[model samples]
Target: MLSARQRQLDRVRTFLFGSRTHYGAVFTVFLYALLIAIGFVYLYPLLFMFVTSIKSPEDLLNPMVQWVPTQIYTENYAKAYRVLNYPQTLTASVVMSVVPSALQVAVASLVGYGLARYRFPGKGLVLALVLATFIIPPQNTVIPQMLTYKQYGLLGSPLSLFLPAAFGQGFKSAIFILVFYQTFLTLPKVLEEAARLDGASDLRIFLTIALPAAVPAFIVLFVFSVVWYWNETFLTVIFLEGGVTTLPMQLSKFAQAYENLYPPGVVNIFDRLNEAIKMAGTFLNILPLLVMYFILQRWFVESIERTGIAGE
Candidate 1:
C-alpha cells in the first residue's frame, strides 16, 4: 500500500516538475539553450584558432573574415615555428610548469591527508592560516620569495621554481590544501572507523582507506595543478632567467622582438607574421589543456557531484 502511494507521489512530483507545472518545460529548454550559448562563447576562439592556424598567409590576410580556410596550408604551423622558438621553448615550458605543479599536488594531498585524518591540537588554527594565505595577494609575497630563494643559493635554478611546490609553500598550494581538506572532510567516517577496528595503523588507514576514497578530489587537484602551472605567467618570469625561461616568458620575448624588427601594418610576410604567430602561440598553449579537459570532462563532472556540495 505504501509502495503504491509512493509511486503515485513520484509520478505527481515528476509531472509537476516536468511539463505540467507553469512554464516548467520552458525553463528547462531555456537552461539548455543558455548552456549551449555559453559553451559556444567559450570554445569559439579555440575553434577559430584551429582553422586560422592552417590558413595560407594570403587567405588569412584576405579582406573579409572567412570562417573557414580556403586552402589549408599545413606548413604555416612550421613557418610559425621559426618565430615561436618552438622546440626549446616548448621543452622549457613543460619542465617549468609541469614539474612544480605535480610537486604542489603531492605536497598538498599529503598535508591535507594528515590534517584530515589525524586529531591535532591546533588543526583548526593551521587550516585558518592556510585560508589566510589564500586571501593574501601573491604579488606582495613575490619579492620576499625571490629574496629567500636567492639566500638559499637556489636563485636562477629550476629548483627555485619547484622547491616551494615541494613543500606546499606557494600561493596556489594554499588553495590546493583547502580543496583537499574540504573533500577529505566529506569522506564517510565509518571507513576510517572500520579500518581502525581491523587493526589497521593510522598510516595504513590513510594510505589504503582514506586516500582510495578521495580519488575524485585527487582528480580535481590534478586538473587544477596542470592548468594553473601551464598558465602561470608571473612566477615563471621572476624565478627563471634567460636559459630556463618558460613559454610565457618566451612569448613576452617574442613580442618585444617582433616589435623591434618590424613596424605594424607594413604588409611584409615577416611583419604580418607577428599577428598569426601570436595566435598560433595561444593555440599551441591552450590545445593541450582543451584536449585534457574534454577527454576527462566526465570524470571532472562526476567528481564535482561527489565533492560534498551536492550531498550537503
Candidate 2:
C-alpha cells in the first residue's frame, strides 16, 4: 500500500512538471531549451579561448578542428603574468575594489535605513530622484564628471571613486538604497521604539540596533563590490586616466595590442604565444570573481530574496 501511494505521488509530480493544459507547458519547455542553446552559443568562444590558452604554439595557431590542446603549455599563464605585471595590477585592482564596495554598502545601508524608518517631507521626491539617477546614461555623465573631478583636483585619484561611495553615490545607489530600504522597512517598528525607549539616540539606533542586524545584506553587498570593482572599466578609465589601471582595462589593453598587431582579419603574422597569453590573461582576470561567486553566491541570493520578501 505504501509503495503504491508513493508511486501515485511521483506520477502527480511528473504530470505537473511535464504536462500542459491551458498553460502551455510545452512553450515553457521550448523557451527554456532556446535560452539554454543561446547561452551555450555565447559561451563557446570563451570556452575556445580557455582551451587555446593551454595549447602549445603550433597547436594554438592551427585553425583546424582541435578542441583540446595537442600539447598543453601552462607556461602561457606565466608569460601573461610577466607581460601584464601582476603585482602592480593586483595592487591597483585591490585598492579600487575594496574601498568602493565597503563604502557603498555602508552608504546604501544607512540611506536605506533612513528612508525606511524616517518620515519626512520630500521623502517621495527623494525616492523619485534616486530612481531617476538610474535612467541617466553613464556615458553621458563621463565627460562632465571627469571635468568636475578635474576641477576639484580629483582627476586620476582613486579617492574620486571612494569618496562618492563614502557619501552615498555610485552606479545605482538608488536601487541599492531601494533594496536595503525595502528590506529594512519590513522590520518590526517595535524594535526601534524599544531601543529608543532605552535612551538610544538616532545614531545609536542606526549603528548599534540596525546595522548590526543586517549581516545577510552585508554579505550581498560585499559580493557585489567584488564583482563590480573587478569589472569596472569606463568610469575607472576616465577617472584614473593613466594614473591607475584595473584588471579589465589591462586585459583590454592586451586585446588592443593584439588587434593592432594583427588588425584582425587583415593580418598574416602574429605571435602564437601572445595569443595564448591573452587567453591566459582573461582567465586570470575573471578567476577571482568566479571564485567569489561560487563561494558566496548562495548567501548573496538568499539575502536578496529574504530581504525582498520581508519588504513585501
Candidate 3:
C-alpha cells in the first residue's frame, strides 16, 4: 500500500510538470503577457486624449496635473461639437460612408459569385487582372480618374464615389471580392445541386442558399468599409473639394476654424481651451465608431472566425 501511494504521487507530479503541459503553460503565459503589453502601448494614446479633453484650462497649465484633472471641463465637448457642426457632418459622413459601403458589397458579391461559379473564356486572365489591381496603388490612377470624372461632370458630386463602387471598382474592392470568392468556393456543391434538381432557378438558389451562408462576410465588409470611409481625408478632400467636410477633415482644420469663429484674444496660443477643444473633437469623431464596434462586436468576431473557417 505504501509503494502504491508513492507511485501515485510520482505520477501526479509528472503529469503536472510533464514536457507537453510545461511547454504549453510557458507559451500561454508568454503570449498573454505580450498581448497585454501590446494593448497598453496602443491604448495609451486614446487614454491620454480622453484625460486631456476633460481637463480645465487651469488644470492643463499646472505642471502638476498630468493624469487626472482637478475639475472636469464638460464644456469642451459642447464647444467642439459646435465647431465641428456635428449634426450636419454626422449626416454627411453616414450618407457618404454607409451608402458607398453597401453598394460596394453588392457589387463585390455579384462579381465574386460570377467568378467563382462560372467558367468563362479568359477566366484565369480575369482572376489575374483582379489580383493585379490589388497591387496597383489608387494614387497612380487618381489623375486619370479625376480627368474622367471631370469629363462626366462628376468631379464635385458624390456620384464620383458611388458610381465607382456600383461598378465594382470601389476602394480596396478586390479584397472584398476575394473574400466572397473564397467563401462561395468553400460551400458544398451538394446543396446547390439539390436545389437545381428541384427545378430552382440560379437566382433562387443563390438568394436562398449561398447568401445566407455568407452573412458573416457581409457584416465584416460593412464594418471595414464604414471605418475606412470615415477615416478617409486625402481622397475626399480632392474629390469633394470642400463640398463635403467630414469629422476627420473638420478636426484637422479645427484651429483655423476656431480662430475664424471667435476673436483672437478669446483664447491664447497655449490656452487649454484650444487643446481641449481639439481633443474633444477627436473623441467625438470616433465616438460613433466606438459605439458601432461595441454593438456589433460579437457579429464581427464571429464573421472573422467564419471567414477563416471557410477559407480553410
Candidate 4:
C-alpha cells in the first residue's frame, strides 16, 4: 500500500511538473496567465474607449458608474458621425492611405531588388543615403518640401504625397526598402542562375524568379505602409490641409467642429459636447483601421511568418 501510494504521488508530480518533451500543467497555466495579463494591458485602453463611448451623459456624470453604464447611448455616435463627416472623410482617408502605399511599395521593391541582386558603383553610399533618410526627422525637411510643392502648384494635392512615394521617399520608406532587400537577399540564387541560363533578361529573371518569392514581403510592406499613411497627420496636415480631410484630421478638430454645430450658449447642456461624444469620435476614427486589421490579419500573419521579420 505504501509503494502504490508513492507511485501515484510521483505520477501526479510528473503531470504537474512536465517532462522534457512536454510542458506541465502548472507551466501551461502560468504561460496563459502571463499572456492574459499582457493582452489586458494592451486592450485596456480600447475597452475603456468603447465603454465610455457608449456611456450616456448621465453615466459620465454618475460617480457610481465607472465601467458599466446604466444605458447604451447611441446619440454620441450620431453626433460624432456628423462631426467627422464620416462618408466624405472616410473616402479621403482611404484614397490617401492606399494610393501612397501602393506607390511607395512599388518604388521600394525596385530599389530593394536592385540593391540585393546587383553590384554597382557607390552601392554602399547609396545604402548609407537610404539609411540616413530613415534616420533624419521629417520635421527638418517639411518646410522645404512644402515650399517646393507650393512653387510647383502641387500643394494641397495628392501629388504632394504621391511624388515622394513614387520616388521611394515616402514615410518610413527606408525600412520598407530594407525589408525588401533582406527578403530578396535571402532568395535562392540558383533559381536566378537557372533562369539566366535560359536566356532570360535581367528584368525577366527578377519578374519570374525574385518577385514571386517576395510576395509575402510585399504584402507585409503594403499593409505596414497603409497603416502608416492612414495614421499620418503631420504631413497630411501640412500638405493636404486645404484640399483633403481625413478622419484623423477631422478628429483633431473635433472640438471646434462640435462648437460650430452646437453653440455652447445656445444649446441645452444635455446637447453640448462631452467626454462621451469625444470618445465616440475617437472610436469612429480608428474603427476603419480595426476593420482592416481584422480582414487582413490572417494574410498579415502569414506574410510576417514567411518574411521572418521578427527573426531578422
Reference-based lDDT, each prediction = 0.74, 0.77, 0.82, 0.92
Per-residue lDDT of candidate 4, residues 268-309 (tens digit): 999999999999999999999999899999988987887887
Candidate 4's error at 132, in angstroms?
1.0
Predicted structure with the largest TM-score when compared to the true one: 4
Q: Which candidate number would show the highest lDDT if scored against the true structure?
A: 4
Ten-residue stretch with the least lDDT total in model 4: 303-312
Residue-level lDDT of model 2, residues 1-312, one tens digit each, is: 569889998776665566444334556688899999999998897798888788777776677838867777887787677656678887888888888888888888888888999999999999898888778878877888789989988998888788888888775666677778876876667877898999889988888778777777777766776677668887888898777878787887886654554465775444433667788998888877777778877877877787662444
TM-score on alpha carbons, each prediction? 0.80, 0.81, 0.87, 0.95
Which portions of model 2 show Cα errors greater than 4 Å?
Answer: 1-43, 63-65, 255-274, 309-312
Lowest summed lDDT over 10 consecutive residues: which window, candidate 2? 16-25
Note the residue pairs that clash in candidate 1.
none
Q: Report model 4's TM-score to 2 decimal places.
A: 0.95
Clashes of 2: 0
Which residue window of length 10 is worst by lDDT in model 1? 267-276
List model 3 lDDT by residue over 1-312, tens digit each: 569889898777665555543644456677889999999998998998999899887887899999989988898888888889999888888888998899999888888888888889998998888878889987888889888988988886888788888988887888888888888888787898899999999989888988888887888988898888888887777676657777787878888877677657886654424677788989999999999989999978886886873343
Residue pairs in clash, model 4 = none
Query: lDDT at 61 for candidate 1?
Result: 72
